[model samples]
Target: MERSETTATTRLSTWRQVKRMKLLYLLLLLPVVQLFIFQYIPMYGVLIAFKDFKVARGIWDSPWNNFEHFRTLFSDFIFLRALRNTLIISGLKLVFGFLAPIVFALLLNEIRHVRFKKITQSISYLPHFMSWVIAASMLVEIVSPQRGIVNYVITLFGGDPVHFLASKTYFVPMLIISDIWKEMGWAAIIYIASMASISPELYEASDVDGANRLQKMVHITIPAIMPVVVILFLLRLGNILEGGFDQILNLYNPLVYEVGDIIDTYVYRVGLVEYKFDYSAAVGLFKNVVGVVLLVTANLFVRKVSDHGAW
Candidate 1:
């Protein structure tokens, strides 16, 4: 009888706590519902990957093909080349692009002038809002060998104009540099917020020890944000195959396909253009499986080292 009373009291306490936070929970409902509808429901369609998918038969009625597409995927040179390019681009971006935000955040944190810092941050943020279509078009104009600003500068230096986007020599670097330019500022916002939450008392204590700004930042700010850095890096590692599809699709041409083609663009041509949905789905599912493996592995590694992870 006493145990039953205790259980009843615990249930009542839980109900009261929920009632107190009811509005907040209500606010969370929309996103949870949307995720179930758009994200979770669509996952059922992934079964088509293992099936001989047909438009008429639909995802459920499709006959099971059982890894035939995957077999073809492994043998195909075109898919292999796309996979190679995707890894190379994604790896380069991970190195440069991931570091960019942390560097930008640190630089912004150093600026003493309020108005100037705000203006600089605002300008950096603008590129992230622009669509890749518009941004890539502008980028093309900026690098055009015939009449672009970059070529104009080269000629000013008595050098012949270079086709930056077309040449494989310049293509990977261009992609990495452009990606850094587009994403660095927006990604830095997370680091900036992490920095903001750091106690000012830590800096004040460092000042008393005769620490210089660089020393204090090194010891205090960077260390304070290491967890955030570790978590972000782990997340990036998980998506190690996500070479920027829209950006490359817009900017790259046939000339640079050897260096620029990625799984996404390859999938686009196969699925949408050629109407090979099953093959495309299999490739996508393969990429996603690889990503999940990487994510889990990275998470485990980070947790072991620093005790910081997505969990």
Candidate 2:
């Protein structure tokens, strides 16, 4: 009888605690509903990957074709091309785009002037706010062979005008450079915030020890923010197969497709434009599965190397 009374008292205390937090729990309902609507609900479409989906039959009535779509995707040369380009572009971005933000943050942190630093940061971050469509249009105009400022400058220097966007040789480099420009400043914001959290006393101690600016940066600043860098790098590895779709779609032409086409663009062309929905779904599912695997592998590697991980 005494043990039962004790149990009832514990239950009453738990219920009172939950009742006190009811307002906070109610506030979370919207986000939970949004997640269910936008993320979890759409996941049902993954079944289309296994079905020969027809508009007339609809998703539920569509006949299952098993692995036929997967076989078709593997046999297609274009799919292979898309896969290869996706890897190459994503790898290059990981190397260059990933480092650009870190460098920018370090340089910005070193600036001593307040007004100048604010102005410079504002200018750097402006490009990130522009839509890819607008940015790509501006780039196209700037690189136009006939009337562009770039070509005019080339002509003034007695050099041949080059069609940068159309040429296979230049397309990949342009993609990498433009991607870095678009995202660098925005990405640097996280690093700058991390740097701000580091105690200023550390830098003062380094100064007292006769360390130069570069020395303090190397020994203190970089080491302090290395955790953020590793976490971002691990997250990027998860998207190794996602060659930026919007930027590429806006900038690419048939001439540069050999080097510029990626999995997302391929899906757009084959799925929506050509109406091969099932095939596209299969390709998407494959990409997602690979991404999950890569994310898990990268997280494991990071956990082994350091204490930090996505989990």
Candidate 3:
């Protein structure tokens, strides 16, 4: 009798499991359908990179070029410059941009006045919604040698007006600063959310132990949010090759190209404008390969060192 009851119970559980799975599939049917239609369907076009990609002969009939495109891309002069500039810009942004948001989040968390904190956050976050083109125009206006607010401030302090945007030496710094200004508050939103999850009891306990605000922040708050920071930092390592293309493209001029040109702009100018599709595809493929390798390596390293990883 006991064995018969156990078998009947098992059969009932299996039926319930099948019913739940069917319900889940019904709920997910639309999103899965959309992903297949839009995302997976487009991947078939990547074959163009492997072909000579003649317009007359569709992707199916285009002759295979094998590695010829890659060879030409590697030998191109501007490709090297673009690669170097991309690395420099991305490295700077990764280091400085990453830290700025965390610092801002911490500072905002310390604010005792709710209204002041909200006002400051709102003001800082407003710039993030502005388009890159509009932001670039604002940057040009502010850094213009004559009649700009920055230059006017310098003159008021008895200093000569500096043409910040015109000089290549200052262009990278300007990009970093402007990007930080636009993104820091928006980026801090995640860190702030992470910080909020930390138990209030931890702060109270530290206070009872004679810990000051700064000490509590350093010892309690920072440690609490560190896992989120580590995860974000690891994720960022995957996209180091992208290098804020739209912002750089909008803000840069021919004079600043040597220092500010990156892979996306390079690909745009050469592939779309100049119509060297094969070469541009090769360069883009190279960047994607590096990004994939970095993501995998970083995830593995994080897992080994901290036991926290993307996977």
- The 10-residue segment of model 3 with minimum total lDDT is 42-51
lDDT (tens digit, per residue) of candidate 1 on 1-311:
99999999999999999999999999999999999999999999888888899999899999999789999999999999999999999999999999999999999999999999989988898899998999899888999999999999999999999999999999989889888888888999999899999999999998899999999789999999999999899889989989999999999899999999999999999999999999999999999999999999989988888878988
Instruction: Give the alpha carbon lDDT tens digit for every residue of 1-311 in model 3.
Output: 99999999999999899887997878899999999999899767667777898878877898998878887777888988999999999999999999999999999999989999999988888999999999999999998889799999999999999878767889999999999999999999998889889898998898799999999989998988888888898888889998998898888888888998999999999889989776677788899899989999998998898867788
TM-scores of the candidates in the order shown: 0.96, 0.94, 0.90
Lowest lDDT 10-residue stretch of candidate 1 = 302-311
Candidate 2 per-residue lDDT, tens place, 72-170, comes to 988999999999999999999999999999999999999999999989988888999999999999999988999889999999999999999999999
The weakest ten consecutive residues by lDDT in model 2 span 302-311
Error of 1 at 284 (Å): 0.5
Best by lDDT: 2
Query: lDDT of each structure?
Result: 0.93, 0.94, 0.89
Kindly report which residue pairs in candidate 3 clash with one another: none
In order of TM-score, best first, we have 1, 2, 3
Better of 1 and 2 by lDDT: 2
Q: What's model 2's lDDT at 96?
A: 100
In terms of lDDT, model 2 sits at: 0.94
